[model samples]
Target: MPKITDQVSDSGIYLLEIVVPDDFYTEIKKYEGRKFPKGFYYYAGSAQKNMRKRLERHLKKNKNIYWHIDYLTSRFNIGKIFYFNNCGKEFECDLVADLIEKFGLIPAAPGFGNSDCNRCDSHLLYSEAPLDYSHFISRYQSIARFIPSSNDTF
Candidate 1:
């Protein structure tokens, strides 16, 4: 597993592996003209100034719903978080495209968490199973390498 050794640069991209258990009832009926089932939801997001704060807000249970991902995070629990420390802005969309093109992962909903990016159909990807973290750590190479953080449940 990857570890967090630096705290200076909080700017980077993150992928949230949110798991809605098989028995869990998903509250979102429809979003952006699409429907999603109970499964693993991967949301790609970036925090240029404060990644820690952005992540904390996402994991918080009682926060207000602002982003598209909040609709789900407010209802379900996040299973894992993977991040690229000190990374640039472009990687947010690149990461989403990687999952769709290389891993064959499909978008959970169109335009979900991708209002600012034109390169992706959505920043959220869905799978019927768990995601393999090794894929990012092993095969991918960016200016700032992707690492699995020690953060768990905020």
Candidate 2:
């Protein structure tokens, strides 16, 4: 299916919601030296002006592994991409914090995709089951949208 988004702003926070298959968890641990259990993960990030470019780059399989998120996105498919467009730059970590505090999400890998963030243990959050995206958005109280697929080109 074609990826859809409601791009109403130039910048805000986003969550790359991905599912790591049970068997692939071992491969990720071996390659990245990080223990990630089989489950859903949410990686919170932000863009100042080029949110589309950033999101597009993240969904591609063929890209140079620059950021920690690149390691996972290069291998696993992002099941969903959530965009919170009305927030400021600081909302990236805020989103992660909310996931942990309200939704009981746990940090998967320390310093994973949050090198500059001191507020979060990791940008990547883990849960055994899928996070209720709509519920989370209702609690978030901000302008948001979600792209249902990641593999398809925009």
Candidate 3:
């Protein structure tokens, strides 16, 4: 399993890529077209099962916001969140992180992580690849399955 880390929020434009199973689409639809308040970082994360449950945790008003997304969401109106159905596993986090970085995005949480994220002593694993962010944007647009058309320019 890859280690997950939290970053110091920079309040930069961020793209959250959440992976969900096909059955979770219904729940994802609830927040479709919803924009999180600005100054707040959008909380984005993935689950191997039960997207609703995981998302619910994020929505909980009383919960402690540990993840970058959670803390950020509390402050900013999530400009938009992209949901990718049928995705599972932690390695994908790295992929999504790379994609987000391709757009020259900065880390909401920059220095926090464990061994899984740091495969080497000198480099962080999540920082390994130059994300093809545009590819994902295009894929979401082409499929039409993703909520809030990418053209909306959130």
Candidate 4:
């Protein structure tokens, strides 16, 4: 397990906890006619360089929507962020797979945030109930640092 840091750094895997207040439908680029239900969602991603900048971009309301997660972040609110610094991209896929295996979470959008990934179904996981971050950490035995939306400086 890697050391979790408070500030986002060069390389790591991150999980964004987002809230969707109402049900809606949107065409997520290639994933057309997808329905986003009203609930909590966990989006996993990895940034090999400029991780802090990437996270800052996600925290912002206005930006160029290049990624699928950007589409959701533009519309929804990210409540929390859990990240493990120095973790590789492969860890991201493992985390997503673990979420599905343990929590039986389904993809909010197929092929979302994982266009470059060939191993995972999707990087975004949906659940009606709030996810237990501590449980996830213990299950994976991986250290993670929490960043609330209120404390996002960048």
Across residues 27-68, which tens digit of lDDT does each residue of candidate 4 receive? 565766766789999999999988888887887888888888
lDDT of each: 0.74, 0.78, 0.36, 0.81
| Alpha carbon deviation, residue 119, candidate 3 (Å) | 5.7
Worst 10 residues of 4 by lDDT: 1-10
lDDT of 3 by residue, 1-154 (tens): 1111222121212234322212211112323443332122222344545554454454444667665345433433322344444444443455445545554434433332222344212111222233354676775564212333233453
If the candidates were sorted by their TM-score against the true structure, best first, what order would they fall in? Answer: 4, 2, 1, 3
Predicted structure 2, TM vs. truth: 0.85
TM-score of 1: 0.80
RMSD of each: 4.1, 3.7, 14.2, 4.4
Residue range with the least summed lDDT across 10 consecutive positions in model 3: 1-10
Strongest candidate by TM-score: 4
Candidate 3 regions with alpha-carbon error over 4 angstroms:
1-44, 59-62, 66-68, 112-116, 119-135, 140-145, 149-154
Q: Cα lDDT for residue 126, model 4? A: 96
**Model 4 / residue 152 / CA error / Å:** 13
Best by lDDT: 4
Candidate 2 Cα lDDT to native: 0.78
lDDT of 1 by residue, 74-93 (tens): 87877777778877889888
TM-score against native, each model: 0.80, 0.85, 0.44, 0.87
Off by over 4 Å in 4: 1-6, 140-142, 151-154
